[model samples]
Structure formats: C-alpha cells, structure tokens
Target: MKIAFVANTCWNIYNFRKGLVHHFLSKGDEVIVLAPKDEYTDRIKSWGVKWLDTPLEGTSVNPFREFKYLLRIYSIFKSERPALALTYTIKPNIYSSLVSKWTPTKVICNVSGLGTIFLTTGLIGKLALILYRQAFKFSSYVFFQNSDDRELFTSKIKVESYKIGLIPGSGINLEQFKPLAFTQNTKTKFLMISRLIIEKGVREYAEAAKAFKDDKNVAFTLVGKFDTNHSRSIDEKELKQWITNGWIQYQPHSDNISNIIESHDVIVLPSYREGTPRTLLEGAAHARPLLASDVPGCREVVKNGYNGFLFEPLNSSSLINKMKLFLSLSIDEKKHLANNSRELVEKNFDEKLVVDAYEEAIHRIIKVS
Candidate 1:
C-alpha cells in the first residue's frame, strides 16, 4: 500500500510523526510526505520516503492563499495516487479532505488541535468552523487528540458524529523517552518546553520565573522557538530582557532534544490549548513530574496532585504556586511522582499504541475500499 501524509510543514512530520512514518515503511508500505519543504526535507528523504513539497501559506486568512494551497495539494494528490492520504494540522485536514473526496484514495484527517482561530471569537473563527464542517463531511475518519476537541467540533461545528475518533496526541516512544533518575540535589531545575508564544503560556512561565528568581535553589529554563504567528511571541527584545534579568535560561529549538529533557528536574507548560502536547508526553515518559495549565489537552495527560499539577489557564500566580509546590517536594517524593508519570505514559501514550491505532484505522478504511 502507498501512504501519503499531508501536514502543514516538514518540521511537524520530522519532530512529531517520524516514528509513525518509520512504522509504515517497516511494514513495506510506500510512504510519501506532502507538505512544505524545510531544513528537515533532506532528513525525510534519508528515511527512504518520497518528499513532495507543497507550498502552504501557514496562518494566512486570505482566501486566495487558501485556494492556492488547495490547488497545489490537489495536484500532488492526483499525481501521487496513493492508496491512502493522511492529513494533519488545520489547513491540510480541511483542504486535503475536500480534494481526496473526489479521488478513489481513502482520506484520514487528524485534528491535532483546534488552534487559536477556533478559540478566538471573530469572523475568522466562524469561517474556520464552516470550512471544518464542510471538509469533515467526506473524511473516512477524523482522529482527535482529545475528547474535548471532538466535543467542540461536534457541539460547535456540528460535524457528523460517526466521523470522529480519539487518539492520544502523537504518542510518545517509551523506549526513547525512558524514565530518568530524578536526583533532587542542591538545586532544582524546572523546564518549560514549547514554542515561545502567548497561547503556549510562555509569558506565564517567564512571570513565574521572575517571582521565584530570589530562591537560589530554584532555576527555570525554557526550550522552544519564537512563534511568529501570534502577537504575544517573545520577541528578541523581551527574550533578551528576561535572559538579562536572570528570570530563566533560554534554549533554541532543535531536533535532538532528548538531552534537554534529561537535564531538567521538572517540566511545565502553561499552554492555553493543545492537541496532545508532545513535550509534556516526552517529559512524562522520561518520568519527570510536570506543571501545566488546566486546559483540555494538558489536563488529559496530567492528573492534578498525582503525576503532575495543573494551574489555571494563563494565570501566572497559579503557575508560580505550582512551581513552589514542586520546589517543596523532597527528593524521594519527587522520585515517586516521577515514577508515576512514566507509568501513566507507558499505559496511555506509548508511541507503539498510537502507530497501531493509525494502522488499524488505515486497515479498516482499506477493507471498506
């Protein structure tokens, strides 16, 4: 079978779903990637899969740009003629679903997250819902990372009930993200891994860090890219200010990010929303306790007072309070919570389970075809 994956960017495929692609290839299926080429394009090719560059105007609300992206993807779909087409993220799921409806190939769309458009009330939000309702009409299966997103799509946009299925966000690899020893030594390091954007709670983390900077034993670190999509992105000026003020240590994004996870004592993400946060799963798989917002995606992974704690969305004081709780945990207590985190991930968010779910969905579609 030939499988084609349509996502927003090559980076998304490389960072989040490489394991899924490899799983497909190992099963002797021809895998093709249809998305915008990036620095990771060559790396995908190295996996012996075909990479088709489809230009996408990400975060653009212009109808003309959307039409162009649809045309480009439609051309690619017609040419590739794969047995199945899997789409992820917002634009690809909407456009690819519409394009594949006329083709003989089966289409599966993953609604990774609702994103800011759906969360914010405006003309754009209404337009996005309309597109989603229309696009999902013909999809074989629309996989949601969380039940809340599924509920929102059905309740808000009123998509057909039979079209949706639930899966934990791109599952974590148990072996790759093995449990790390949490040696609560002299100083405790807290890590927040996410794109530096307002929606991601980057500002909240920074604020909490500032509030806790006086405590010599507590240190904060941030790992992520500067998101240019949102207005609240930590611009160079602000990031430099925080760094100079010694609020938190900042690290740029990278593909090989395992070492960074291993180096931290705890993980925190104050995201306003998420699909299934890959970083949170990674931290949990590494058996590191977490601090995240009490939002849909984050809440699904973290059971408050168990493996991790959840703060009110966008509340810096709540985030600070949670960080202090983490700070107060003794070495043995931290270790116990860390172990619980690994157990939760192994049972619920294993990468193998995610791959199996996708494969099963594909097989079911093929049987019907």
Candidate 2:
C-alpha cells in the first residue's frame, strides 16, 4: 500500500512523525510526503520517502488564498493517487480531505490543536467551527491529542463521534528521552521551551522570573525560536530588552531537546493553549518535574500536584507562586515527582504506542475501504 503524509511543515513530520514514517517503510509500504518544502524537504528525501513539494502561503487565513490552496491540494491528490492520506494541521486536514473525497483512498486527519481562531466565540471562531464540521465529517478517522479537544470539537463543531480517535500528542520517544539521575546542583534551574510568542506566555514567564530574581540560588532559562507568523510574537526589541534587564537567561532553540531537558532542574510551559505540549512530555520522559499553565493541553500532562504543579493561564503572579512552591520542595521530593512524571509518560505517552495506533487505523481504513 502507498501511504502519504500531508502536513503544513516538513519540520513537524521530521520532529514528531519520523518513527511512524520509519515503521511504515520497514513494513515494505511505499511512503510519500506532501507539504511545503523548506530546509527539511531534501533531508526527508534523503531518508528514502518521496517528497511532493506543494507550495502554500504562510499560515494565512484569507478566504481567497485558502481557496487557491484547496485547488492546489486537489491537483496534487489527483496526481499522487495515494492509497491512504494522513494529514496534520489546519489547512492540510480540511483541504486534503476535501480533495480526497472524490477518490477511493482513505483519509486520516489529525487535529493536532485548535489554534487561535477557535479560542473565541466570535465571527472567525464560528466560521472555523463550520469549516471543521464540514471537513472532519468526511474524514475516515479524526485523531485528537487530548480528550478535551475531542469533546470541544464534537460538541461545538458538531463532528461525528465515531470518526474521532485519541492519541498522546505526536508522542515522545522514551529511549531518546531517558530518565536522568537526579543530582543536587547549586542552582535550581528552570527551563521554558516553546516558541517565543505572547500566546505561549513568554512575557508572563519573564515577569514571574523577575519576581524571583532576588533568589540567588534559582536560575531561569528561556529556550525557543521567535515565531514570526504568530500575531503575538516576541519581537527582537522585546527579546533584547528582557535579556539586557536580566529577567532570564536566553538560549536559541536547538534540536538537542533531550540534553536541554537533562540540564534543567524543572521544566515550564506557560502556554495559553496546546494540542498536547510535546516539550512537557519530553521533559517528563527525561524525569523532569513541570510548571505549566492550567490550560487544556498543559493540564492533560501535568496533574496539578502529582507529576507537577499548574499555574493560572497568563497570570504572572500565579506562575511566581507555583515556582516558589516547586522551589520549596525537598530534593528527595522533587526526585520522586520527577520519577512519577517519567512513569506516567512511560505508561500513557510512549511514541511507539502512537505509531502503532496510527498504523492500525490506516490499515483498517485500507481493509474496509
């Protein structure tokens, strides 16, 4: 069987779905990729999967542009004639499903997360819901990273229950993110790994760090790239101001996420929303305690007091209070929490489990189609 993965970014596939792609290839299935090409496009081709460079404008929401995109996707789907099409992100899921409706091929759409448009009940949100309702109704299976998202889509967007499936984000590789031995270091270092965007609460984390700057024993590190497309991106000027004022130590994003998690005492993600935070799962798999917002995606991974503590979304004082609580725990207690985090991930969020489930879903669609 020929399998095709349709995504907005090749980087997402490279970062999260490499294992799934390898699993299909190992089983002697022909695998192809359909996405906008970037630096990673050639790299994926080097790994033996065929690449179809479908050009798309940057994550824009203009109706005219989106219609043009749908036409382009339809052309690609007609030419490729994949036996199964697995799509991720907004445009790929809706447009690819719409295009594949004419073919006998099965379509699997992963609603990774409902982005900014779905967070409100305004015009755009209503429009997005209508689009999702229509698009997802046609999917052979719609995979969601968290139950909260699934419920939201089912209730608000009016998607069918039987079409929905659950996955633990893209999932974390336990072998790649092994548990680190807890060692007492002089400084209680806290790391926040995410795109430096306002919606991710980057500024809130900085303010909270400033509140604790007097504590000489605790250090805060911010790691991630600046997302130019996000409306609330932390611009160069703001980032420079934060660094110059000594609010937190800043580090550029790196592919070496496991090592980054290992070096930190605690991991933080103050995101306003998520599908499921891949960083928090990675940190937990590396036996690191968490401090994240009490939002949908974050709460799913950090169980308030069990594996980690949660703060109010976008509340700097709340984040500061949680950070203080984490700092007050004894070294042994912290280690115990870290161990529990890894145990939770091992049992519920293993990367192989996600791959196996996806493979089974695709095969089932193929068998029954």
Candidate 3:
C-alpha cells in the first residue's frame, strides 16, 4: 500500500508526523510526502521515502493562486494515486480533500487547530468554514486535536459524526524528552516557546515579564522564530523594545528544544487557543510544570494545580498571578508539580498512541475500500 502525507511545509511533516511515517515504512508500506521544499525536505528524502515539492503559500488568499494550488494537488493525485492521503494544515486539508473526491485516493484530514481563520467573524472565516464543510464531505475521516474543535466543526459543519475522531496533538516522544534531574536555580526560570505572533500571546508574555523586571529572583526566556510572514506576527521593533527593557531574554529557534526545556523550571504558553500545543507536551514530558491559557487544548493537558496551572486566555494579569503563585512554592512543592508533569505525559500523549491511531485508521479505510 502507498501512503502520502501532505502539509504546508516539509518541516511540519518531518517534525510532527515523522513517527507515523516511520511506522508505515517499518511495516513495509511505501510512504511519500507532498509539501513545499525546505531544509527538511532532503532529511525526509533520506528516510527512504519519495518527496514531492508541492508549492503552498499558507497565508495567500488570492483566488488565482489558490486555484493553481488546487490544480497542482489534483495533478499529484492523478499521477501518484496513493491508497491513502493524510493531510495537515488548512490548505492541504481543504484542497487535497477536494481533489480526492475525484481521485482514487482517500484522504484523512487532521484539524490541528482552527487558527486565525476561525478566530474572526469576517468573510474569510465564513468562506473557510464553507470550504471545510465541502472538503470534509469527501474525506475518509477528519481527526481533531481537541474535543472543542471537534464539537465546533460538528456543530457548524455538515460532516457526519462517525467520520470524526480525536487525536492527542501530534503526540510526544517520551524517551527522547525524558525528565531530567531537577536542580534548584538561583532564579525561577520561566520559558515560553512559540511563533512570535499576536494570537500566541507574545505581547502578554512580555507584559508579564515586565511586571517582574525589577526583581532578580525571577527570569523569563522567549524562544521561537520571528515569523514576519504571519499576519499576526509580532513586530521586530516591539520584540527589540522588550529585550531592551530587560523584561525577557530572546533566543532564536533551536533544534535542541529538549535541552532548552531542561534548563527552564517552568514552561508557559499564553496563546489564545491551541490544537494541543507540542511545546506544552514536550515540557510535560521533561517533567517541567506548565503555565498556559485555560483554552481547550491547553486545559486538556494542564490539570489546574495538578501538573501545572492555567490562566485566563490573553489575560496578562492572570498569567502574572500564576507566575507569582508558582514562585511562592517551596522546593518540594515545585518538585511535586514537576513529577506530576512527567506522570501525566506517561499516562497520555505518548507518540505511539498517535502512530497506532493512524495505523488503525489506514487499515480500516483499506478494508472498506
């Protein structure tokens, strides 16, 4: 059987779906990837899978460009004709599924998150919803990262309930992100890792960090790529201002995320929403306590005062309060939170669970076909 994984970027498929791809390859299934070429394209090709460059500009809404993208995917399906097509991100899920309606290929769409499209009430949002409903009508299955997303789609879209499923984000590799021995740092280190975007609460994080700027006992670190291309991306000038104000230290995105997580005492995500953030999962797997917004995907992982604490989404004051509360904990109390973090990931969010779900879905679809 041939399986093709499609997404906006080669990097996304390489990092998030590598386990599932490896699972199929180990089972002697031919696996191919369709995504825009990036630094990770060659790396994915090295894994003994075919890599097809499919140009997809995620933020572009130009009708002509979108039509071309659709035609390109249609051509790929017509030629490759894989038994199963797994798609992630907005464009792939909507466009590839549309193409699958006329092709022999069967598509499984992964709704990682609604993103900015669903956050607005504008024409774009309504159009996106309509597109989703039409594309999903042809999909073999639609996998959501959180229950809230599933409920939203089922309520607003006309897709059948049986065609929907829930998956734990992309799942985390426990062994690779195992808990390290905790050591008390001179200052309580709080780390936030995400694209520097407005919807991600980058501004809120900076404000919270600014609140404790005069104190030497608390330190904040921000790590992520400066995504100037994103509509909601934080301005480089503002980021520089925050750094100049001595509120937080900034680091460019790094491949050594595990080591970076280990160096911090707590992981924080102030995003307005999520589809099960991989950062929180990685932090939990490393036995680092979490501080995240009380949104659907986040609340699923963070049991308030259990493994971590939750704050009001987009509320800097609430984040500050939680940070202060965490800082007030004794060494033993802090360690307890850390231990619970690791325990939670062990009980759930293992990478194998995601691989198993995809494998089962593929087998079921194949059996039906």
* Candidate topping TM-score: 3
What lDDT is reached at residue 138 by model 2?
72
1-369, model 1: which lDDT tens digit per residue?
Answer: 889989888888988889999998998989999989788899888999999888887667888888989888778878888878888887888888888777776789888888655667766667777887788777888889999888877786656656667899999888777888878667888998888877888888889989987989888898888766755567778888899999999888866677888888888999999889998999999899988999989998998988989999979999988888877778888888899999999889988888888878877778733
Model 3 lDDT, residue 343, Cα: 93
Candidate 1 Cα misplacement greater than 4 A, ranges = 229-232
The C-alpha TM-scores of every prediction are: 0.96, 0.94, 0.98
Candidate that beats the other on TM-score, 2 or 3, i.e. the better one: 3
Structure candidate 3, residue pairs in collision: none
> Model 1: what TM-score?
0.96
lDDT against the true structure, per candidate, is: 0.85, 0.84, 0.89
Task: List runs of model 3 lying over 4 Å from the truth.
Answer: none
Kindly give the number of clashing pairs for every candidate: 0, 0, 0
| Model 3 lDDT on a 0 to 1 scale | 0.89
In model 1, where is the ten-residue run with the lowest total lDDT? Answer: 156-165
Worst 10 residues of 3 by lDDT: 115-124
TM-score order of candidates, top first: 3, 1, 2
Cα lDDT tens digits, model 2, 1-369, are 888899888988898788889888998888899888887888788879999877776446688888988887777677777888889887788878777677666789988777555664555566666677677767798899888888877777766666778999988888878999877889989999988877788989889888877888988899988877766588889888888888789887786877877788999998888899998998899999999999888898999888899999979999999998988899888998899899999998999989988977876677733
